[model samples]
Target: MIVGRRWGDAVDSWVKKMQSLVGYRTFTVLTIVITGLLLFLLLINGVRPEKYDIQEFHLSTETIRSIKTVEDPVKTEEERQRAASEVSSVYQFSEEIGENRAAIVTSVIDYVLEEKAESVESLAPMEEQVSDLKENLNVLETDGEGIRFTDGALVSLLLLENESLINLRDSLTASIRDIMSKPIRSEQVANTKNEIERRIRGNLEIPESVLPTAVLIGRYSINENETLNEELTQARIEQARASIEPTRILQGQVIVQEGQIIDREVYRQLKLLGMLTNQSSMKPILGLILFISLCMWLLHMQMTKWRASKEERQRTLLVVMLILIMSVIGMKLISLVSNNFDVSIAFLFPTALAPMLVRSLINERFAVLMAFLTAAIAGIVFQEGYSVVLQMEIALYLLFGGLAGLYVIQGAEKRSHLLQTSLSVAVVNFVFMAFYLLMTQSDYGVSELLFYGIAAITSGLLSGALTIGMLPFFESAFGLISTMKLIELSNPNHPLLKKILTETPGTYHHSVMVANLADAACESIGADGLLARVGCYYHDIGKTKRPGFFIENQMSHANPHDSLPPETSRDIILSHGSDGAKLLQKHKMPKEIIDIAEQHHGTSLLKYFYYKAKEEGQSVNEEDYRYAGPKPQKKETAIISIADSVEAAVRSMKHPTAEKIQEIVHSIIKDRLHDGQFDECDLTLKELKTVERVLCETLNGIFHSRIEYPQ
Candidate 1:
């Protein structure tokens, strides 16, 4: 049957190879084609030239309008021509009259009084005469051409003058009064006064002469009206020209016929569209390179600190990638939903979820690192309209989420415990949100608060659930031994412990006593009592293989030590530690527990057997009788070693009491200290004292008056 089977297997192998040749070739060709297509697509989209276009627009030169430049001086002929043009368009000045007539009369009176006297005191005696003069002047009137005095005194005085003098005085007074009454009719008043004066001059025999040229003032010129469209076009042209060049130019330089086809309109449009030619393209490229390098460096640093197995590293990498992708997707969805639907939907992607899951499943340090990384990534991906609140929410959630996982799961057990942890995280998240809202005085309604609460709770719970669900896979794949697993193994009824109890009852009882002592000492020193207790349970497991050969497992009928030589007995006792470690490894026990079993003795001397051999006159090296050990590597392991020795020593004491037990425990600790058992661990003198006190108290309780009672 074996020969026939071998022959048939060889034939089948040849037939299968021939059949797979075509399939293998097809698979190889398909893989190459897919790879080539993917490369082509990457090349097309990843490397393409940018385009630039120019557009035409009108331009106005502001420099031409405001720039001061040297020019040839104007000649006398040019000045004469300009003056003639100005004189052609000039208008005679008009004086406003009516209301100011009293002011002019007052001014004339003041001028006559000032010319006659310097001060009011010199003119005081002529007050009555001045009053009479004022009354006569007030009665004067201009009837179209000449003055008419209603006062008889002025008329008689004027008639008594040489008839010509009378006429001249009347004409002058009439012209002055008319001009004062109608100052706006300056041309009419001047012409009438001149004709009257000319007539008077002829009658008086004075020479006729043209009046000196009158001082003429011209009115202001009016500007032409411009349409709105023309003004707007001019403004646009000026703006375009102003934007095209720098404002200031160097001295001694002149701009002659500046180029106007630079297409400022196209440049402005490109700037608005973020496609300007002046911008550095390398900026984004540098940023991308820096960001990717930083991310890779951070990833490498995190993996190094984690020191995880290859499988564990891969799994963590996958989970982190998934988280990053999911976070990006969630941010995109939030933007879409909030923009198109409602803003309340954005509350769903709470930053707390990522850190919570990471901390619960991974270590605390890694969780915190991931939290920071996630927050930074979320800030970049989830930014909406430059809102700092969103970034703050991400940072706060990551911080509290990591803290929640670290605090709640420090020594946690069941999956349900993570739910409790989630509740704690939710409370923290809600408080943070509420505080933020209150501080900013936001107009968030009760519904918004409710949404935040629901989001926080749901996120925390989901994170915890995911963490718990992933723990088993991570543990198995990475060969991780958690604190919870250690606690379970420490149970009295564990299969290994049960086997020790059934096969070697004495060793089992000794281990239990050691566990009690070690737990008390470790707890007092702030060490891990659970690790110490669990280590004690399996510390003497090797005694089970050869039960009768060891003193702890030897029954009353057997006296193997009496029959065996001192060297042989010491060998048997020392070999048990190494044997126990091997058995644990065979059964796939954790390395930590195996370490405790191997290092409990730590090469300590077997004094009794060594002395016994010396007394028997047998030459034996003391090193040959010592137990082989790698020594305790931690405080808990060192404490357990001492406790193991202390427990067995105190058990052999006669009539032990609280005081006696205290003395014995202290002695054992002191001896272990002197032996340098704590050299490898971080235990200090203060912690050692606390351990001694706890041991004394626990030992006193165990050996109390009640325990000494007989039935």
Candidate 2:
């Protein structure tokens, strides 16, 4: 035993040393990091494991599935490129060049014919004149290569009788101008040259030599007037690419069928779906770590940055992490089952269970944080090897379901209210799923819709059912006094409450009055009003143990304390505080309530009994006449202490009024403050003033005077 005790002591000492060394914030960070690492490890497997562990040629040992459906980036890119390529390239037309070339050719031909050269002797001068005309036109210079005339074409032009060359020139220039006026792309130059040649030969009765020259000139003059418009072509290609939607595989879609040969195409698909037979990659592991880290950071921010009390920060963080870990474990188990069975009903997991529990036992801000974190984790864990759309839908389901449960349970009272919340959450979930299906335009058979509907509804129902069943355990294990538990304990039907009402009715009424005062005062001071009220209800439960011994329950004016020894009476009164604490502990009440019961009357001297003993010629130790207490440690308990005293004092007044109540309350508060009763609690002077004002107002209302009616 000694060895075991020493070991336990050493372990506790080590824990204390570590806590002191690391400090609260550092300890919180380390805890969150450890939780994130564990969650990352749990979910890294769920994030479609690195390539299936199969050999290239080996028979498939197990059926491989994609965890989440994702877009085939390579295939989508290829398809987009092909679509872009199929778009015709844009071209810019230069009509100015075509018109200038037409003018040059026509002018050259006209100049040659107008010379009227007699024969071959004059042909040289005529050719010189044509060349001069070409130079004057300046169109050929733009082309950089001057047009060449066919053999005998110049002599044929000079020898042409009548207006033959002129007519041919006009015909060729018109055709060339018409063709070049529009966009003549690079690929169309040859066909256009041929068409011009044919038009010159057919439309004009020109000599064959002249026709060849006309064709050559037309082809040369045409040039590539229409150049490719790079900017416009690129814009069109981008537009076409934008029109093509990304091709993605749906979640749970088979990448490679069972027993199918893993050919190149299948292998590519497997690799894209993260099912290829390759070594584990750090990319996914890093991604999971980052995502879990982000969740932990959000949790930390909510805890440290929110309005949580300084003393409860560590405990709140611990509880939230514990709840989140449990939730993630539950989700991971469901994912494993879904993966193994290839079922789509993993959505039926009670994702809302944790959020509702957190909202109930902790704060709503933490619950909201848990809702978002749970959704983000679910998105990663429940990814289908199909498209991202399914993953988003799962996230939506978790978020809406958790939020619905959280909101529906707010202000809930009776046990049946929880069941009503379940139904309400089911309706909300149904609407969410229906909206998703409608927006996505997903085609579903009756059976498929029924399956999803059942899952959605079941998710909400299971969340409610699990939260209802698990709440008490968390409350009991963590010593958490949730509003629901407080309400239940406050019920008159409870055994302890019933015993108080039946055996000590006057004390019960006095407790109720104290509850009213404390509730109002606590609320006014920005403290927990419900907690104060509930604590006040149970603060005097021990008086029921010996009902008649207390003055409040003794209906007959004959005082039981008058007959007993002052020391005995003092012991009986002090024992009530301890007795009330023991009774509360026996009933498994929350510690806050027990503390209020035991500490409302701090370690103050029982002056009435002390003075009675002193007057009776008996020596009384002041320490023995005081109630043993640890003092009120929280704002709510401290407020209850002051409010209880004020209520009993005001009730005993002969003529109660607002001014009288105010003076008495201030005096009582001042006495408590001076006696160091409020020293242990963190309540501020400002809060105390607010409590005094609220109590004064409440007392005024309860004891307000009424006008007499006419007789």
Candidate 3:
């Protein structure tokens, strides 16, 4: 409960902070988010489910396609209707129909037999006998209590012996009872009666003329025994309807062909899909605004991870914003053209190109953030429609491609190394495509594979080509010093380098040696080794201004410092740092290079000069002998300071063995540490120890493998 309360309090605090934001901070954030919204808005229009303008009977000018799969209600209803039509009606049977019909037939037979005993005592001719029996049975045919037979049938019965008449009665009665015992619907009544008559007549127990009388009597007595079951019949219809499968309209299915009339059913489908829009839709636009806001927040979090000044952060934001806008514009072009082809054009998008450009222009650390941001955008811009929240394949492939390109571009210090980035991104994209294929239970045709392959390769090549073309423009426009720029400046023929070589070759040699040492030490401590190496090359360029006054260029063994006052020599040495900074600034060198040229010495005392004046019995101030210092402000500059001091101190030793080199290296590093040369920078005591260990090892390698590095 306490933790929860604390969390709530923190959230409230954050909300308050956000509400209180003002001025430049608010402006910067607003600018980035609004710019992102405008860029991505171009993409959302194409990705949203295609809306149409039509009504129930309007004709369509173009083919209208479904952007997603949904159930087709009209087709589903037709299927259910077909299923219901096949269901037969149900009927209920009565259990007592058989006994009722049998009893009626028996009573008529008894009446006939009784009449035969009472009324017909004497024999008669056959015609008269048939006429008499027909008259007697006419009484049996009376309302609801009748057995009707023709004259031929009565004659056959009257002429039969007494035993045959009894047999006929039993047989007809049994047949009627059996036929009514099982289920029989009202529709089957006539067929049942005929079947009973056939059964009696086929037996041949009596003469053929007698057969007709038996068959007619049995046929007249049978009745309907079953009625229709309305409830059960309706239930069967429902069950059959439930068994049918619903039809679907798959994504990309054409609702109406080009130039076809928009029928009622198709219009309903379009309305159901939310495509028949008359008014403008603001939902996707609102959603895009929220999406871009979230992206800006993520970028802010990444920027916070790097501790930079407000100006630097603002600059980075604009750079990232420019790159993202370009990326979206690229995606928009691809989306527009994708409609012209059968295959998706998403694979041709150079999502990885953004990361490569950032990596080439900015430091690799910031490029990591760009990769994630680019991938997140791909998740949106490449989605199938507005309803699909994300497309995992395209998003993940972008992520993999961006990261692969970034990793490969890390070794790129020259323009030629960018080709490796193309190959790396292409390989990752292809592998991810194959992985998606194997994972999905779907098949791809040969033509589809060919299109996909071309798209992937095009994406890779585009990344490399765009990066190469954009780097020089960005560097010139932004005044940024990337590794490639730093490497270019380090070449021997550059004007500044040539000046030092021609005028002060001794200092040139010294600068090169310092470059090797600083590069090795900076790399060991995870500093910017390349920047340090390049900075070392130019740190002593000011020595060209007054060559002989500095001891390294005095080939005649003449000491200009000995002829001059201690203060004059101190002034000359101090002026070199500031003078070098001016030369670099005039040449429009990057600020980092100028900062290294200026801050490498810091404001430490020249104890030799300070003591020499005191020993000469002249009053001296320590500040006058010290270099004017705005100390080292970064890791590379700080390392260059240490490397510069140690390189000069160690080179003065007579027998520079492993132990002597360690002693002098440790002494100089400790002197710089105690004198507060590293105060302004964020280098820790532990990191300084690492620097100390690395320098000792590097110096030993330069001095012929003589010793131990600091443990």
Q: In candidate 2, where is summed lDDT lowest over 10 consecutive residues? A: 1-10
lDDT of each: 0.58, 0.78, 0.78
| lDDT string, candidate 2, 1-711, tens digits | 345434434543654565688987687878788888788777876664545765555566556666566788888999899999899988887889788888878776766655554334565565665555444435445436676664366557666765777777777788878888877777887887777767766864666656666676777777678888899999999999999999887666666667866666666777776665564567766777777778887887787686544445766676788888898898888877786653377678876888988998888889988999888888877776544522777888889988988888886875557777888788888898789779978678888888878888898888888888878666665557688888888889988888889999999999999999999988886788899999989999989888988878888768888789998888889899999999987766776788899999987778889999999999778888878987778888888888888988998899898889989999999998998888888888998888888899999999898888999
lDDT by residue (493-596, candidate 1, tens digit) is 87898899999999999998889989988988767687788899999999988888866666676777898888888888889999999998776676568888
Please identify model 3 stretches exceeding 4 Å from their true place: 1-31, 73-246, 279-281, 307-312, 333-352, 365-404, 419-462, 613-625, 657-660, 667-676, 705-711
Candidate 3 lDDT (Cα, 0 to 1):
0.78
What global local distance difference test value does model 1 have?
0.58
Task: Name every residue pair that clashes in candidate 1.
Answer: none
Backbone clashes counted, model 1: 0
Clashes (candidate 3): 1
